[model samples]
Target chain A: MPTWSRRSPPGWSWPMAEKKMVDVFSDVERETAMTANPAGYAVTELGAEDERIVTLAADMSNTVAEFIAKFPERYIECGIAETNSVSLAAGLASAGLIPYIYSMSPFGMLKTCEQWRTDVDYNHLPVRLVGRLSGLAMGYFGTSHYAVEDIAIARTMNNTVVLSPGDAASCVSLMRSTASLEVPVYIRIAEAVSRVYDEAPDYEFGKWPRLRTGSDVTLIGHGMGLGLCAAAAEALYEHDSIEADVFDAAYLRPYDETALLASAAKTGHVLTVEEHSVAGGLGSLVAEAIARAGLSVRLGQVALPDKDLEVGVPADLYEYYGLTPSNVAAKARSLVRR
Target chain B: MPADITLERGRALTEAELLRRADWVRLQTIDLIAQAGLGHYSSTFSCAELVATLYYHALRLRPAEPNWPDRDRFLLGKGHVATGLWPVLADLGYYPHDWLKQFGKVGSPLNDHPNMKLAHGIDFSSGSLGHNLSVGAGMALAARLTGRDYRTFVLTGDGELQEGQVWEAAMAASHYKLGNLVAIIDANGFSGAGPTSQAMNIEPLAKRFEAFGWTVREIDGHHAPVLLRTFDELPDPASEEPVAIIARTRKGHGVEFMEKQPQAWHLGLLNAEQYADVVAEISARMELANG
Candidate 1:
């Protein structure tokens, strides 16, 4: 092994390779990067305001190092023990401190689901569980790391308030919004996302933020679901001249029935989209509401199949599952045309 | 915290008194299980002495002020033995002693496991194994960060050691140097399946704890005098190491039939005759204690 010190044994630096350094992206991709890593900002801001806001990550200091640096005494580096990190958060919550536990989606939500249920949700402890890289965000990591089923597993737990942010702004606002809720909360975050809002919108629990207005059809989504719905709305208006009301159904559990029903009544047709399995996710939540309320609106779901996932990039999985904006627009057009 | 078993002070409990309390816990455990016609028996009996020592001699708690900020916290890591602990809590004046008779009755707050909200004097509610330690570590950390002097104790099961969460907590407790936190694993050698060795060998637990940076202690779990002394001597809270007391014990401490039974009365009905026999056996054991 060759060892290099500050002296630089060989030509380690000053090697300038001339290349055309250009930022390549269409007008759309630029906007997507505007709101990346929202939860990190939200947690850092939350820590600044409240001294009781402590953070613990299971071997994820890199993602949360800035927040840890800001609150060194409060930050706990839990070192890959997802179960312990969550259980420790429960303990920290019990001791009158608000603990924000962060980790990769699968490990944070699914790996420690029992711990979350028994420790935090069971007592309604004021602990926040944030699952970063949710859905197919870990596209190449395969099924083990995918958190598409996070909504299904997290929402079904007793007294668990499951929140999934569609973009950077919603993710940040919703993180701040949950400060007062004295219940266990699960926040699923996605990295590769589009900035749906120009600025932070007024986010409320159990209420959908109505993004675009239309009377023909309703496009509902949460987490990555909202981003897809927003794009599909743009696609619908540009191509088919069909306008659909798009709502951010980010709060998956204790879902906003009033808003959903009212939107369904206005639109008379509903289309749901999400980067998750069609079963036990945003689509399922909307479908259950439509049936239970005896709504007459036509319902369609643009979501991944509940089967073995095909290996590919996040975009590949999304496109294959018909999770693209065009697929969502087409689905909404068919529902409204009916 | 900060105290190891080498020192002793306070109103020291005699071996006889500790034995008497153990008898009381055993007797009440039998009745609680008998009334429900189903409850953990041998598991509870195995830790009878340890729990009795903690409540009667070790923990610093005011029954009247269960939430006393300065008071020590006790979390039942092995919540299956919660039925055996109710009598101790009631006898300590935290709740009415009569609640024991309604162990598992309809609408009764008492369940098979402990619930902090439902049960008084329960600092952390735990049923599934390997959780109480982390919760206790939190309490210990709170005590230290908030400039309070208090200790947190968690009683875990030998079988519960198989859980990965316990080691995670063990590592955290040591990393934080939570000297105020103590973990007492009830190494009764049996779980629901069979012997712990058969299920998953968690032997060499003391060495594992040492490697995890904890002051480890081994003691006869059924002995009251030693437990009382050992708890008193736990290192000072300033020490940067948590404590692990591996209390060696049997699956069942009394009632030979129940002790000898496979699975050791994990859950079953004690018929009227069998119940009377167990009661008689406990009394006879208590008589031997007086001798």
Candidate 2:
């Protein structure tokens, strides 16, 4: 088991040494202290504001219990069929109603890929597909419940927006902000996430939120990975005297290319951390951006491998798969050194 | 409320007129597919009366106002038959008649399948089978929630029932008690490969829907009077059970040669000589129906 180093590096000067460094690791710890699902509260609040807002659940009503309690008439229980729920949402959208369908991540996005392609995005309907317990948050439930391939599948859909919020506040803010979007949206939500913000920061679609600034390396992550990246950046600075910039890459599709290029130019090295597979998640998106711009910056990724993963508690799985802060920091150090 | 079968375009259509319209649908479909270079002729021929009756006598619509808030909605799950629907929408003035000449051409809205985004009157776009039933159920549920009295109709192919999502939608629609939703299965016997039963038997389809809690009605799809009466006698929007009408139809009805070999005619190009024969056959049928 790898552990984060607390000892400061000797005879190294921090570039932003004078600036007050926020304890990002502590912030992440605070964020993970949530007890209730933020999406339920956010959607409930949205239903109160917009009459068109309706929620459909596929045997996952607990994820949006608040919305169900507040707006029982608008809450539709589609039982356990994810494919039907997705198309049903599209049908509701066609009739000028805004619908949000909720399910476990794997079933919500991967199992209904065709429905999303033909029924929802192809029609350009405004349906919100909410996938809870993304990544390995399903823990011992194993790969059947895991959603590492969801981002890859969702980003390929035309006229669709892909969102992954980092913390409870950001999740709420993102849900509220994207309530009336004209195009379909796939929102990836973890069961629990570390705090990347003190409150709901103002969210802009297709833009990355800069969490911490540095000149040595850029660290990008989203959803559960954002907190890990923030903590990793903190560890890198404390142990190896490496100043790393951290960004919350919330939007997977229509990513913030300008910010990515500018950060790569400034830092010369980029590291992406995600709970998804390295093939088509945040790492691939960043790699595509860097390669498209013909940038000479070196890129490193700390993510799950492209293979079937084993079943375990989320913490043990994160440690084994190198999804912890220590693993991210080690990968960042290697990138900076190279 | 049941559809007002007596009035269409502010005038009553006689049974002979509706039968003539069905023949016209067959003729127009042949012309459209001949121009497009490729299409599903047998599939369109199978549901000619169902399409004609829905658009002419069964549906409430303001043709000039295609986006009427309370209008009846129709979805084509067996979307290959979209060629049969374009002519009816054009005749109703949904879009210009010239659009039909450009069918399947690049940048044309009239593709082989329905696209609600590109076309004016399509309630929902469909190509991949087994999705429109769920979509139609959603529309019906929306009407129920919003206090709207519009009915949603979905036409699916018999082979389309092989897709598991169709059953998923069937179970859910019945579970939700969506009475405003009606599913018309065009059981034309043949699919793209061969006969639907040989490929993947969806036999006892009526019993299957009934077991899922839908009110089932089996009818002869090619009969104009039966088609209109079935649509007119649909369950009320406020009823508890969804309705499924099993429309038993021939793969190809009017054209003699195509009727004999449905598998080969499933998708084919009609040359000028064959097109003339098909048009003449439908014309003679229309005249006989008129008499």
Candidate 3:
């Protein structure tokens, strides 16, 4: 079982030192034990229910292997053409079929931005674009494979619902929820992290999930960043007796403004952490929201610098960029103390 | 439906009537562009007969039911020539003929490009080049998956062949053997800048498509009999090979001055005297054909 399985009631403050000491290997092991790849399972399940659900792969078959195996006729291998695949999905959607295109983040989102803009979003077609290995998860593959700019691009498109899943369970739940959506959706799938929920949480579009409660500061994150926020909250309490509110900002486009304002009002300080550029990722989104709401709250960001990043193992890169729990906690402590 | 029009799905038109309709398309296109003051007149003129054949004779569509699920779909990859298609849709009662005068105006559904959401009878929105073929392939694949027999036809420009995504779609369409998809390339010899060969040669076009595993056919685009015969003999939807029709045509076929200077007339406004000349020429041709 994962160490995060323990539930903490709202307004409850507890030191997470014991849980923090748990090795990263055990977390990976727990994730594998829970589910191998929740996306593949979820797609196969959705295929059984909706015959209109078809999948197009840009030569990324392994990401949706189970669905291809079960419903081979419904799977289209679009070669390595991401642009053509997106337009193809739009064509299918125009003809009363819901099509999903799955590929690595760079090829899926960055390479086919115009296709998504003109072919899918402009036409208001219900095409699902799934981009895996989001952010710096493609660690050693260098800057070419990094998806730090995907969120910025996706959010700029009209009639597109942008979402990032925090864990395997949320990945399944978020994808399944998009079945009845009549507009295009872009689902960013981050690298596997420890399970945040025992089962799938009831998800609502434009609503943020409050993972832990605190009064000193609010830590907002999405996808892999959410897990880091939870760990940083525990560390803040353990080291400096500072309670930090942690939130999962899964829906980036239609983000929950009411919850964000209430949390900012309660904490008076907001810090956003993400495995993306500090320019237009979650940090920029929060800043825009804060300004639009005219809230007088201090905001800080813990994100990758907006420049060319170095190539190395993901763990080494995270440590060098100050994305670890300790670095996040230290940043939160400074924000609360100031 | 319009009170002045009778709705007939797949009405068999005579060769002479088809030719007359093609001339009517040219006349309407000239009028629309002359009204809009900024439109692709030559581009519309090049594909006039092809568009008329598809709308009046080739396609299976109901004017009363534009969104019929089983209706055949038509996408304009070279969407700048949408002026030619709008009039046909209006005549079919997809919308009122009065909307043709509102072309390119603010809030008008009829822009220089085709938008499926804004306009009736447009199967897909297309302005950016080289996207509609892939969209057609997608619709073709959808037909097979959904067990529907609706065919999808895409009209692409010769210059649009330069876009990499077009070939990407070409490769995928042939790879999937999308027999329900038909690509009609308007090889009018000129693009917006100049002649396609001088700008970027896409010659040996038929062999290129043959190499991509598509059934290739070439014909004089302006000839009504050839256009009708080629469309009638298209491969079955259940067949294994997609079809590519390379329609050899002039940049501006009917108008004498425009045909002479295809490069200059690619996009230009006609003065009152020039518009009168074009009208007289088309009317003379109609009278000659009728006699």
Candidate 4:
């Protein structure tokens, strides 16, 4: 029975310790911070130029305190009610405002999924949805909070653009790109990622961003898995003498069929990586597209198992789910050697 | 006229004129529904006078520009009621009357529910029950944030209250002090299954809204003048609360043989006998009111 104050002993906060562990991967994690999450922040940045930019959140304004500090009027905290937060955002869009809604991934996307599909997607309103700590990032919190199937559910909706930025830099870039889209966009974020890609190539909303080039095998990763994929590819060259191609399918819904087809043609073997469940996720989408196009490529997926996850540190969970560099590297080696 | 049920002097219209307009809208809805051979005609017929009063004398709107930011937003939560909504939109000049001829047709914007894309005057797409109230609250909140005078009004079916999400939104609307948002529950005592009371009694509906911190009003929904006045005279939400007016109405209000008949809850190809009965009843009421 201890009070949760900032003055508490060093190890008082589990989330704080969790933050430290994620920092070890800071080299790559920092590359994927969210661009337009907590709609309050994104709207303030865009509202200066576009009067239509507005934001609504599910009583989580304190998480994006800086945005609220800067633009109090634009931020709305619906006090822990995710359903109202979504419905309100739809209403704002109907009133001619570009609305962005922010909430935890599970509640914001899954819990209010029907509202998202019927109210926003069906209407094709420019309502931006930002989901934080997606996938197993909420590992310690258990099933109710984890957004493991967000990508799978969102991809099924028509006229929806799903973005999973690998690092903070890409998060910001993707945010600015998808902000002006006429249709709804779902942006999944994993804060403080480690890998930072070179900013030389311009980022496109629906096009996959290539982080590393290789001819022997193709490693596909979305959102937080990009760094692991890159590390895995590098390890393949160092230990096994196989040059693996690392492609970031930043946008999950509109899978880059052309890039995927071309890479499959070059490598002949494809491996998709993500922190989401294997069922109906990025891997399934890729496999379906490759099969449809009649492409002769061996497709493989490295993903979290479909079940309720146990509580633990994020790194431990990531490692357990075969998302770490070592596991990813091993998977790549086996695929290329096969 | 009860002084309390009087509309603003300038906007008020004779009950005969309102009833005539409502009847015309009803005829248009019947034609469209019959042509489509599928619709929520019974539910829509029940709300005709209420919608007519609001558009003509209550809500501030611009049919020419449906997306006018300053315009008042009207959300139809009872989506099954869309079958009747088509003609009302046309009568308001939101679209041509001919457009409704394509109701339920493939590629026609007019589906069973109101779609802002296919037609004008609808603020949001609502066929899924218990969603429009929150959207209206959002519009009202947006008005407050932007410092606009526009208000938001939502009309939902009594059965839709069964959704837990509706109460969730009801609580949020009151918490935000959305005085600019007004909810009108069409308590016609019927739902998809049967009588709303039998399905689930929502008695003391006004008290339920009042308990959630809303200004409450109960009135006969078919009375145009009373309906218009209720909208006009809505209390300032009595200390920043939202407003809810429980509209007491019959499931099939205008047409005889359909009213209070659970079997007539939703009409199918109106048989010659039933159609003749409805036509005779409406003609008699139209004459009595006209006289």
Best-fitting candidate, measured by TM-score? 3
Candidate 3 lDDT over B1-291, as tens digits, reads 543343333469778888888889989988899888967878888999899889988888867777777788899999999989999999988889899989988999998899999998999999999999999999999998888988899999999998999999999998888999999999999889998999989989999999999999999999988988999888887888989999999988888888999888888889999989999999999998898
Q: Specify the poorest-scoring 10-residue window by lDDT in model 3 chain B.
A: B1-10
Please tell me which model should have the higher DockQ, number 2 or number 3: 3
Ranking by DockQ: 3, 2, 4, 1
Model 1, residue B24: C-alpha shift (Å): 0.5
What DockQ was computed for model 4?
0.70
Scored by lDDT, model 1 comes in at: 0.82
Show how many residue pairs clash in every candidate, following the order shown: 12, 1, 0, 15
Better of 1 and 3 by DockQ: 3
Q: Sort every candidate by TM-score, greatest first.
A: 3, 2, 1, 4
Relative to the true structure, candidate 3 reaches a TM of 0.93
TM-score of 2: 0.92
lDDT of 2 by residue, B75-167 (tens): 999998999999999998789999999899999999999999899889899999989998999999899888998889899999999999999
Taking the tens digit of each residue's C-alpha lDDT, what string does model 2 give over A1-338? 97867776787766652212132113344433242577777888889999999999999998787788788999999888999999999999888899999988999899999999999999899999999888988777667878889998899898999999988888888888788799999999875477778777787988898999999999999888899999999999898999988898888887899999999999999999888898888899899989989999999988899987887767667778998888889999988997
lDDT of 4 at A106: 88
Residue A142, candidate 1: Cα error in Å is 2.2
- Residues A1-338 of candidate 1 have per-residue lDDT tens digits of 96767686565787542321121113244443334456777888889998888888998776676787788888888887999888888887887889899899989888999999999999889999999888887776678878878888887898999888887788888888888789999998876567688787887778888999998889998876788889988888888888889999888887899999999998899988888788898888888888999988788988788888886567667767887778888888888787
Comparing 1 and 2 by TM-score, which wins?
2
Residue B285 of model 2: what lDDT? 82
